[model samples]
Every structure is written in C-alpha cells, then in structure tokens.
Target: MKTLPILLSCWLLLSSCGNNSQPAADTAATTTPDKPAPAKAASKPTILFFGNSITAGLGVDPEQAFPALVGQKIDSAGLGYMVVNAGLSGETTAGGRSRVGWVLRKPVAVFVLELGGNDGLRGLPLTDTRRNLQAIIDTVRQLSPQAKIVLAGMQIPPNLGADYAAQFKQLYGELAQKNKLTLIPFLLEGVGGVAKFNQRDGIHPTPEGHRLVARTVWAVLQPLLRQPMAQAQ
Candidate 1:
C-alpha cells in the first residue's frame, strides 16, 4: 500500500508537469506575432528638361550641357531629383510639339521648356511658333497636370532685324504670362555676345559658358527643389 501511494504521487507530478508544458505550447502556437507594416513605395520626382541644341550642349560634351550641369547641381545639393535632358539638336518649337507626348511618358515634377530659337533663326512665322509652343504646353499639361513649368526665353542675332528680334524676345514673356509659368529671360544672356564664351561659330556656348548657364538655371530651380519631394506636385 505504501509503494502504490508513492507511484500514484509520481504519476500525478508528471501529469501536472505535462499539463503545464501543454498550455505553454498551445499559447505559443495560437498567438503568433503581428505582421510588420508594409513599407511605403519610393517616390522620386523627375525634372524634365525639354529644349533644343542649347540644351543638347551642341559643340560641347553632353555632360557639359546646361541641363546636365543642372543635374550635377541637384546631386551636389542633395535635392534627389532625376533630371531628364530631352534636348535634341535642330529641334524647333514645331518639332518639340510633335515629340512632347512621347517624352512625357513618365511623370514629371518640373518641365523646363527651351525652344523657339530655331524657329526664330529660320525666320518661321511667329504665329506658327507661338501656336507650336502653346501646343507643347497643352500636351505637357494634359499628360502631367501637376507639373511646374519653366519657360526659357531666347534671343536671336540682330541680323533678324531689331523688330523681329524684339518680337521674338517678347514672345517668351507673353507665353509665361498667359500660362502663369516661370520664365528665365534670355537663356544665353551673358554668353550670347561674348566671343570667349561662345564657340567658333559664334552660336553655341562653350563648356565654360555652360557653367554660367547652369548657374542661371539653378537660381530659379533651387527654389522649386526646396519643397519636399512629396509636395513637388
């Protein structure tokens, strides 16, 4: 009778231990840790530079172009924007209008338009040039409604006659006023008449000249970039 009681006590002790372990195992199985929250998608804003040979950096290294230089400034300043240099040599306002839709395939936070110089050089009718520029703007607005626009004003040599030159320069202001956009009056400001800044052809700017142009663009562009990336739209 004594041995039976001891065996019963031992059995009860083991059963109690097993019952305690079972609850712990059950709790572990039933109560899993909560899943971590999903990560947010990265949103990098794109600054698209749309223009002609000046933007293309003709007669100079493409990297030395004002647009690319602007990109360098953006990187240096930690602005964290993607700069798309969509400049094409020999592109006129009409040409830009035709290709703008294709270029704006992706989202754009800022749109820098630098065209109409070729139109002026070729003596194309100002009305046609204006219409083409307006069309390009319309296309940009349609595709990227939230994008900020910067109009690059251009000037032609006095050979086109003072009246024509005056009208050409005035057109950019008119466009900016009408569209309520930012304007960079005279893209080739200091480099235009300066012999050292321009190439042998007396047209396209040299690499050093491009630096000045980049500075000019950066002046207006830096302010826009100061806004948070989420607020760029």
Candidate 2:
C-alpha cells in the first residue's frame, strides 16, 4: 500500500516534533441539554470518535473533520445518532487509556476507538500499545456493556523494522477478533500517501482527505449500526 511511504515521511517530520499540547474536545453534536433544542435531538444516541490528531482534524476546519462528516451523513440518513469527536491531538494509547473513562462520562451507543497511531508512529513497545488498547476496550465493555465497539486500524512505515510494522498493523485485527468488534481495516485507505490529500506536514489529512476517510469509516460503521447490538457483541 502507499501507507509506508507516506508514514515514512510522517515519521521523519514527527521525529523532530516535540509539542504535545492537547486541545479541547470537539463534538459533532451538542452533548449538553442546556441549549435550546427539541427534546428528540437531545435524546439521540451518540457515536464517539476517539483518537489523535487525525481524528481532531488537525490543519483543517473542525466541521471538515471525518467525524463531523460522519455526523452529517448520519443526519442525512436520519440515523438518529449523535457524533462526538473526543479526539485529542498528539495523544498516544497510554494517554487514551488514562482519559477514556472521563470521555465516557456520557452514554454512547457506538464507540469508535481510533487510537494507537501515535504509539506506532513513535515506535513504542508493541506490547505496551497492545496492553493500553486492551485496557481501553475493557473499560468500554465494563462501562457500556451494550455498546458496539469499532476499531480503526492504522499502519506505519518499516523505519521501525519490518516485523514491528507488520505486528503493529496486525494488532487491530487481533483485537477485533478477540473482542468481536467491528473493524475499519485502514482508516486512511485512499487518503494516505496521496500528496493532495495530506497537508504540508505529510501527516494529517486535508479537508478533502477527511471526506474520503469519512466514507471509509461510514462503510464499516453504517452496517454495524444496522446490526443488532447483541449480534455485534
């Protein structure tokens, strides 16, 4: 796939990058009832997109983020689901493990776990990344037994070693099979490694890139939503 070259470039840039500041949560729908709105809107089910910079829509308008685009598709289809962008920039699986509970304070019908990309990018221990991700999955299962979990798979260049890169790419499938979760094989399918789709950083997707991402995610998510929650478990 074109993922290797793109991610190799990303690794080079990220190696020299040191900032890890996190921004506020970006939600596609209003979670609070404080605003003036119809009761029906307030009671919609939530689809939480939790991940790092890509999920945060870095370098693009918030509305152009893939999660927001998914939210729009959900609305257009009258799916009656709210999309919550709980993505935090520069977050690793360890960080996600530490904060997932807080982000799950509200009820969520569909929980899309998009983390671990940073862990892979940094070439951290695959075991630790696996453990942290498992912890996050367990937490969601414990807290929301009926919620359907969706795993967003990510890949990295072999700069860290071919074996490591292969294992990292395989991690998501392993988790999904073990947990009976829905899987988005590759979150950046058509967008990754494409110059026009990526920003100058060669990492985060452009607005148009997010559009393709939204479609990739929606393809997996839409079918999952149609299935019975019990079946998804």
Candidate 3:
C-alpha cells in the first residue's frame, strides 16, 4: 500500500523531471578522418551504461552517478575501459529500444542494460516491456557482436498488485537467461527502500547510495573485465 504510493510518486516526479531536463548525452566515442592514429590507438574500449533516472544520476552531480563511480573504480584498478553513461531519466524499455541505435553508433566492449524500471513503476503492459527489451538486446547483438551484455535486474513495489510485482521482478532474470547475459540480481539491492539511502525523492539514490550501487555492479563487472573473452561468455 505505502510502497505503491511511493512508486507512483516517483513515476510522477520522474515524468516531470524528464520534461524539465534533457537526458545526458551518449558519451560514445567518435572518430574523424583528421584524428591521429596514435590517439585512436590509445583510446580505451567503451563500457556503455544504458538505463533510466537511476543510471542518469538524477538529483545528483553527474560525477556521483554509478557509471562514473564505476569509471573511477576501473581507473583505480588500471583497467583499460572507458565508461559512457547513456542514462535517460524517465526512460522506459520502449524508449530504450527506439534510441538504442543512436547510442550504438560507436562500438562498445560491454553494454549494461538498465531500462524497464520506469515501465514497471508506470504499470505498463509487461509484454510490451519484455518485447522492447528483447528488441534492444537483439539490436545490441546485431550491431556489437563482441560486446558483453550485463543486464541490471529491477523490482517494482507490490502496489501495482502482487502478481504484477512478481512478474516485473522476474522479467530481468528471464531476459538474462534467454539471452545468456551476465546479470546484476537487483541493481538497487542495498539502497532500494532504504530511507537513508534515498534522496527526498524516495526513488533515486543519494550519493552514498550510488557508491553502494557502484560496488554491487563492480562485483560482477570486475571479474568479467579480468576474464578472457571466451571464458566470460
């Protein structure tokens, strides 16, 4: 009951936020004819984080976003990967499907799929969400065959109905299994539903919450980065 109101309020806030602000630019790399070859060679492979407000670091400085924090971790570990945060506040799986092509203009080594939360919060049709997500995944495979996909699982509060909540939570695992993607059991794990971890929004995480999110992601991502391609798959 209370959780439903919280999710509803979050959806409304995110919708308003989306209208007021533009989503962050897709930080994918581009090359020009005049670009120096050595500079190109020095460039690191990209790890693209594609998702919604949570990934966009809404209500916080861009640097405090989990993707950026992950970039910091990568640097500290001396991993040769660049993070491109392609998070769009209020984005749904359908929106992600529509825009993912532009985001994939540049090649990426890893693609972290983080959409669908907004879909669940809005009580949209689960079938549509699943279809759109599968489409996005198919597009990624078509365009970036070598990229490792990391699916970020999400859960909706039971206010929508226990069955809907159960299905929503189960969708991520289903998608991951169907596509053989590396999965993050629940992106918000320790932060979700925790009053201290969320901002006034009671939706988006605080800076400290992002740190916890970054850690959760890193636990799965770190090993992938360290493993050989054949083994990682």
What ranges in model 2 sit over 4 Å off?
1-35, 228-233
lDDT tens per residue, model 3, 107-185: 5688999999999999999999999999999999998888999999998799989999999999899999999999999
For every candidate in turn, the CA RMSD to the true structure comes to: 22.4, 10.5, 10.4
Clashing pairs in 3: none
* Candidate 1, 21-98: lDDT as tens digits: 332221211122342110000134667888898988899866778887887788778776656678889999989999
**Candidates ranked by TM-score, best first?**
2, 3, 1
Compare the candidates by lDDT and give the number of the best one: 3
Using TM-score as the measure, which candidate wins? 2
lDDT per residue (tens digit) for residues 139-231 in model 2: 998887778999999988788999999999999999999998889999999888899999998889998999999999999998887676554
TM agreement with the true structure for every prediction: 0.80, 0.83, 0.82
Q: What residue pairs are clashing in model 1?
A: none
| lDDT (CA) per prediction | 0.76, 0.77, 0.79
| Alpha carbon deviation, residue 224, candidate 2 (Å) | 1.6
